[model samples]
Target chain A: MSETRMPALSRRRVIVTAAQLGAASVASAFLARHAAATPESAKEWLGKLAKGEAKAGKVSIKAPEIAENGNNVPVTVAVESPMTAADYVKAVHVVADGNPNPGVASFFLTPACGKAEVQTRIRMATTQNIVAVAEMGDGSLWTATRQVKVTIGGCGG
Target chain B: MAADVKPRIKAPATAKKGETFEIKTLVTHEMESGQRKDADGKTIPRKIINAFHCKLNGREVFSAKIEPAVAANPYLSFFVRAEESGTYEFTWVDDDGSLYKAEHKIAVS
Candidate 1:
């Protein structure tokens, strides 16, 4: 399987290169069209209140590097929290950068939840970064991101 | 209408009085996004579990707003601090105002 895929990737690269040289090709056209399909930035889903303030820490995102099918990409997010009354995660948000809608899922939590972790499957239209944001009770935000490559578009289309 | 949408939940049976434990869930549903057509060539009305909430006794601890982009069999894993001995009630709300519920009991030792 590995040997068969190597040549296919290089061939795709060659075709992309040819298309990049002002040659009208179907592959480039599809690329351009599908690329535009992803309009909303992941930041837009993150909310304006957190701009330039969130840092990457105490968060772990689990997602596949290459998803053969984009229909059901299993993703998990875990954050470091004791789930104590005084120090806990208030909410968690998941976003996909390349999907038509960046917002994937939102989870709200309270101190009664002892741990800060969420797992779910999401639809991905293309290869893109999946982001997980955790908002702490102390008004601090943390994030983690992972890239997943999709071979087939998911979303039942 | 989606019927008998089975829900699976795993939570701690016992925990320290002030300790936190994990809750894992998998709710099976087709999550028909209303974009697809049926064999009769008519669009299938959207039916999905749009919201989920976990409560300890009468206190809400965790909740989620699910989206159409979420995949089928919506799997979720989360954590909650076990403050006292009580039953953790989980409810999944379907788009059509139906609810699926599951519960687990934990004893704070």
Candidate 2:
């Protein structure tokens, strides 16, 4: 009986993998032409901003755990930086994983800003993860993510 | 383009030298996301403020690249260090090449 169960589980896993591959192909095709945003597209955007892979640290995103309305959800991103000419945050890019368009906003900073923090409101199409990546003056990248449960969709009229 | 478009700013009128202070700004615009359909089921064209920046005197302090995922009547808050007394000029650039600006004066003691 144990041997039979093992074989069945392995067969199920193969089928699941095949299905995932099929879905991924379809997603990629849609991602190229459609204006809607997906996890893959969001990752691509982050990659462009970071100019490399971003490590998860030194950045924090402040957002509500639950949002009753997806129309306007407040989000704040803060990075740990000295804000000095020698060491400062260059920019912070934000993306919403479940929006029609994931490109939320990008804040460009200078040493005169005196802080590596910015706050803005965003529109969420559904419950999704908000990711922020901060680029440092030394070309290093840091990232953080937060999930918000959006009760209502925001893209529709 | 939307009507009644206006930019409002919130900044300290005075601050100590080398002090870091927060600046908040908001602009009135529909920010049509181009994802919505009209009664005839036609998609509305996207129109939004695409960029914003703040300059202290003649130097750049902060700027932002706005996107469609931003909410309507976009609001942003950032920080600035008061090195010396100067006028802060805030500018918002719209999709149709319209520029909206506002100014605030800060005194550093």
Candidate 1 interface RMSD after superposing interface residues: 1.5
What TM-score does structure 1 among the candidates reach? 0.79
Q: Candidate 1: where are CA atoms >4 Å away?
A: A1-40, A48-52, B35-43
Q: How badly does each model clash, as a count of residue pairs? A: 6, 0
Q: Model 1 clash tally?
A: 6
Docking class of 2: medium
Give model 1's docking category: medium
Best model per DockQ: 2
Local error of candidate 2 at residue B13 (angstroms): 0.4
TM-score on alpha carbons, each prediction:
0.79, 0.86
Pairs that collide, model 1? A112-B81, A113-B80, A113-B81, A114-B80, A114-B81, A115-B79
Q: Per model, how much of the real contact set is kept? A: 0.85, 0.93
Superposition error at A134 for model 2 (Å): 0.2
Q: Evaluate residue B53 in candidate 2 and report its C-alpha lDDT on the 0 to 100 scale.
A: 87
- Candidate 2 runs further than 4 Å off: A1-35, B1-3
Interface RMSD of every candidate?
A: 1.5, 0.8
